[model samples]
Target chain A: MRARLILWGIAALLLIALPPLATALGQPYYVDLARRILILAIAAISLNLILGYGGLVSFGHAAYLGIGAYAVGILGFYGIANGWIHLLVAIGASALVAAAIGAVSIRASGIYFIMITLAFTQMLYYLGISLDVYGGDDGMRLKSRSQFAGLVDLRDPVAFYYVALGVMLLFVFLTYRIVNSRFGMALRAAKSNEARSRAIGFPPYPYRLAAFIIAGAMCGVAGALYANHTGYITPGLMAWHQSGEMMFMVILGGMASTAGPVLGTFALLLVEEVLKGWTEHWQVILGPLLVLSVVFFRRGLAGIFFKPDA
Target chain B: MALLFEQLLNGLQYGVMLFLMAAGLTLVFGIMNLVNLAHGSLYMVGAYLAVTATQWTGNYLLGVALGLAGTLVVGMAVEVIALRTLYERDHLDQVLATFGLILFFNELIAIVWGRAPLYSSLPPWLQGHIKLFAGSTYPVYRAAVIVVGLLVAALLWYVVTRTRLGMLIRAGASNRTMVGALGVNIKLLYTVVFGCGAALAGLAGLMAGPIYAVQPGMGELILIQVFVVIVIGGIGSIRGALVGAIIVGVVDTLGRAFLKPLLGTMIPPTAAEAAGPALASMLIYLLMAVVLAVKPAGLFANR
Candidate 1:
């Protein structure tokens, strides 16, 4: 636990300091990239809630991201500049969608669950493509960054980076609290052995569903942040590849551990950037790394670096 | 009415293609207990190889033969080099490793063939139309595809039910450890099964090359749908794959063809126009969802 604290401490210091460090180094482009990482970290953290704690491998988490993004995009096209509405619709729609998906598909275990989630995400992807009014197959550019009634300006890079950081940190704290709560323990127990937990009078469905929805809502927030960061929305955002990347982050960071997703987000995006600078086909390196990580680092980067006194 | 019949045939052809893809996926899952996401990559390879081979040999039949053989070799190589290590791992590890294989294969294809979709036309013999009924007809190639698919299906059924290889496959699916204890070469059997699955996927790909756009990511797009088929039909059953594939294909095609017109009569034009296409595409997924709700083991789950 001491190691976890120090790890969190270092992460906080870096996220807090990075924008200025980036600016001082005359690499404002990196500040933008950092913003992207923070946003993605938030999403991965949400994924960790269900996948890590509850053992529900949702291959369609990107659908929530897409739903959240398209919520913003659809609203933006209608000139709804209220930030609160964007956030609410993102969370609300994502939770509703998650609830529906969870209610129907959460009964499945293992590969069935994985495939069902994939089907849901692909459905949304096609829906996005079908929306000709929202720019259809080609994505649309936001006319303006989300407006917050002068409380904050997203058009400014540093401010946007801070907002993204603040959102991530808030969720990280929330996640820590929830995972340690009675509900989280029960959910974890259920994941480890569902029938045993049920025999012990702890129903698995509601808790798992709750975790699923909460995670979906959290990812929805990240999706909104993502739209504001990139100033656009596209169907590609919900593709399974994005979900796989997020899974890699959560896996790379370490499951059931707070701050793992943050570390993973940094590692994956950083490697991609550095490798892209070296070669156009960076996936050649990345593909092997993913396989190797699974083979060697079962507990992820967190397992390798910190044993956490277990 | 005539249009309906044609659309029904279209659905059958597409379903047959899907069955070819899903059959391999189901077999590997049932017998080997391995979830190979790279199955789609094999499909893509078949398409690419067939396109290239056709150009090289100037004979479509020979090109298809070569493509199927190439896919079998590639599949076996993948199983030996990558998947052999993964059989004992958890589904998560298997998923991640095979996902990496997908990335590697896609990039490899991009490097070799470029990112653009390849265009492969059907041979002249399979072009034109076939009369199915009075004043109703279908594409000759599609009719040929149906015939070929049925033949393959019949061949598969024969091999699985009437041969020693079929008996071994069934026994392995039922009890892998027992089969191994019975002195079967489990390793060789796995490799052969994986290769056969790849050949099926490849055959589907080569047959589809002339119809669908052959591209780097094309395999994955169809893969998810194939997953839906297996889920609806049951993961480990070939019979389930055939049934589920037909249902999905027919539902998807009929819905796309008629839903717009049907909805237009009930709703405003703008709403119908906007929602018609989305709803149409969602038909197969909806079917899968309903089927799963009713039977969690799927329609014909043997495992």
Candidate 2:
């Protein structure tokens, strides 16, 4: 635990100093990339809640991200610039959808669960595409950065980067706390053996559903941040590939650990960045690498620092 | 009324296409217990190869044969190289690895075919329309697709029900250990089954090429729908796949054709216009959800 804390502390310090460091090095683009990575790390962390701990392989988690983003984009379209409102709507809407989807999906197990989640997300994606008022398939740009009533101008790159970093750290700590709590124990217990958990007076459905909703709501926040960071939102955000990539991040970071997904997000995106610089057809390389990693790199980058499921 | 009849035919054709994809998917899942997302990649491969071969040989039939053969070989190679080791692993690993394969296939296709959509023209004999009723006319090529799909389904039914291979497949699905113990070559059996599944997907892809834009990611557009069919049909059941695919196809096509005008009469045109297309697109997903709520195992779930 001490080592884990120190590791995160050093990581946090570096992130806090990233903007100034990037500026000094005359690589401002890195700050934007860092901010984007931090936002996605939040998403990866949320995925880990149900995936790593609760053992629910929701292949459509990106739907919540898209939902969260659409909440911000739609409200902004209607001239509601309140950042707090965007955050609230993002969370509330995501939770509601998750509840509905989870209520139906949690009844099924294994491949059925994965496919159901995926289909529902695709349903949402199609809905997003058909909403012409929201720019439909082509997507739309944010009119402006969300206003926070003078707390901090999201337009300022450094300010936004710090905000994203702060939020990411907060979620990492939050997930850590949640994973150690009674609810977390129940969630994990259900994951290892649902039948045993039920025999022990803890039915897995309610616990699993609750975790799914929490993860959805958390990812929604990440989505909201993503909209602001990119200043645009599209239905493509919820595509199955996004969900796949998020899963890869969770697996890459090391499942069931608090900071593992954060590490994962960094590794995946950084590698992709380097590969993009190398060639336009980077996916050809990344694809086989992902396959090989799943086959051989079972423990993930987090496995090097922490024991499995530690 | 004639329009409705024509739309129903469209739905049937679409469903028939879906069954081809779902049959292979369901068979693989039911027998091998492996979820192969790259099954759609095989579909794309078949379409690409057929299009390129058709262009090369100037004979559509020969090109199609070549495409089917190529997909079978690719499927067997994949089963031996990538999937053989995966049967023991968890579903999560299988999903990720196959997803990686999807990325590889899509990009490779793009590199070879370029990003633009490829179009294949039907032969002169298949180019005209067939008058089905007083006012409804369906394309001859589409009619041929329906006929072909039905023929394949019937053939599949016969093979699985009457043939020695079918008996072996059924036995393997129920008790692979016993089948292996009885001196069946399980590894070779898996490869053959996987190859047949790929060929089925390839057939669907080649059929779809003329009607749909053959593009890098075209396989995925239909793959999720195929997943819905499998889910609604009951995983591992060919009968379930057929029924589920038809239901989804009919429901989807009819919903798109009628939902707009139906809604327009009750609500404002603008609202109906916006809601109709969106709801139509989501119709099958909603259906799958309802089915799950009522029958979580699906309509024809044997297990």
Candidate 3:
């Protein structure tokens, strides 16, 4: 517990101090990297809610990202410039989509659930491409960063970074709370053994569905932030591969805990960037790296760091 | 009416192709209880190898035979090297490891094949169109695909029911530990089953190279469809795969062929035009969602 607390303290300090450290080092690019980490961490953190805690390995979690992003992009296309409106639309649209998908998909368990979630995600992805009005197979681009009406200017990179950081921290805290609450217990119990959990009279459906919604809503926020971060939206955001990458993050972070997602995101994305810089065909290296990670470190880096023996 | 028949044939051809892929997948799942996400990667490799082999050897059939062998070898190798360790692990672990393999294969293909969609052509005998009825024709290769798919399906059914190897495979699928305890070489049986499945997937890819773009990540595009077939069909049952594949193929093809006209009558032409293709692509997944909703274990799930 003390080690976990220390690890959390160190992570908090590193993230908070990253921008200044990067600025002092004259590598503002690192801040952008940090921004990516925080944004992706938010997505992974939300995924951890379903996958790590609820034992629901959704192979299409990135669909919520697509939904959240498209909500912003569609609104922006119509000239709805408010950031808050983007958040509201992003959250509401993603939740609605999640609810619909979860309502259908929750019927299937294990691999079926994975495939069903993936199918819905691909459907959304194809829908994104078929949207010839937006950009079709290419992708849609935003004209400007979301406007905030003098409250929180998202146009500034650092300001947006801070906002993303704030949102990520909020989600992390929220997940911590959810994972510890009675709902979290029920969700975990259902994950460990469904029939027994049901026999014990704690029906797992509502809890799983509720966790799915929260995770989807959280990822929706990340999606909205991602649109603002990249100043673009594309069908690629909702691709099943992207969902797999997020899954890698959650698993690498150590799925059962909140801090694992943060650690895993930082490691995986940073390793990705480093590899891309070193070689053009980085995935060749990253792929084996991922295999090795899973093979050797099943509990993940956070799992290792937090182990009492270590 | 003739066009509808052609569309139906197209759906049948597509469905058969899905069966070849899903047959192997379902077998692997049924027998090993492993979710090989990289099953698609093997398909992609088959296409790449076929293109390369065809270019190297002037004969297309020889190239295809070689390609299938190569793909089988690679699949067995993957099982031995990477997936062998994962059988004892949980499904999530299998998923992650195979997911890693997908990235590996895609990038490896890009490096080796230079990222271009390899051009492939059907043999002269397979290239011509076959006239079905008055003024209606379908590609001979597609017809061949349908025929081959049916033959393979029948062969699979025979092997699974008649052959001793098939008995072992069936036993393994039904009860792994029991089969292992019964003194059968479970590991060899697994390798053979996995190789056979890989060859089927390879055949699907090699055949597809002539029809679809033979490119990196091509496997992933069709893989989702195969997954849906398994879901709608039932994961472990080959009969379920056959039914699900045909249903998905027919539904998807018919939806694309007929949906626009039907929707145009109900909605505006522009709206129908815009929504048509998207809805067509979504048709199979929608079928899968509906099927899973109605029967979560699928239509023909073994257990």
Residue A86 lDDT (model 3): 89
- Winner by DockQ between candidate 2 and candidate 1: 2
Q: Arrange candidates by DockQ, descending.
A: 2, 3, 1
TM-score of each: 0.98, 0.99, 0.98
Residue-by-residue lDDT tens digits, candidate 2, A1-310: 7998898889999999889999999999999999999999999999999999998998999999999999999999999999999999999999999999999999999999999999999999999999999999999999877799869999999999999999999999899889899999999999988889999999999999999999999999999999999899999999999999999999999988887899999999999999999989899999999999999998888899889764
Supply fnat for every model shown.
0.62, 0.87, 0.76
**What local distance difference test score does each model get?**
0.90, 0.94, 0.90
DockQ (Cα-based) per candidate? 0.76, 0.92, 0.82
Q: Which parts of model 1 have CA positions greater than 4 angstroms off?
A: A308-310
Model 2 chain B is weakest, by summed lDDT over 10 consecutive residues, at: B130-139
TM-score of 2: 0.99
Model 2, B106-190: lDDT tens digits are: 9999988899999998789889998886867889998999999999999999999999999999999998999999999999999
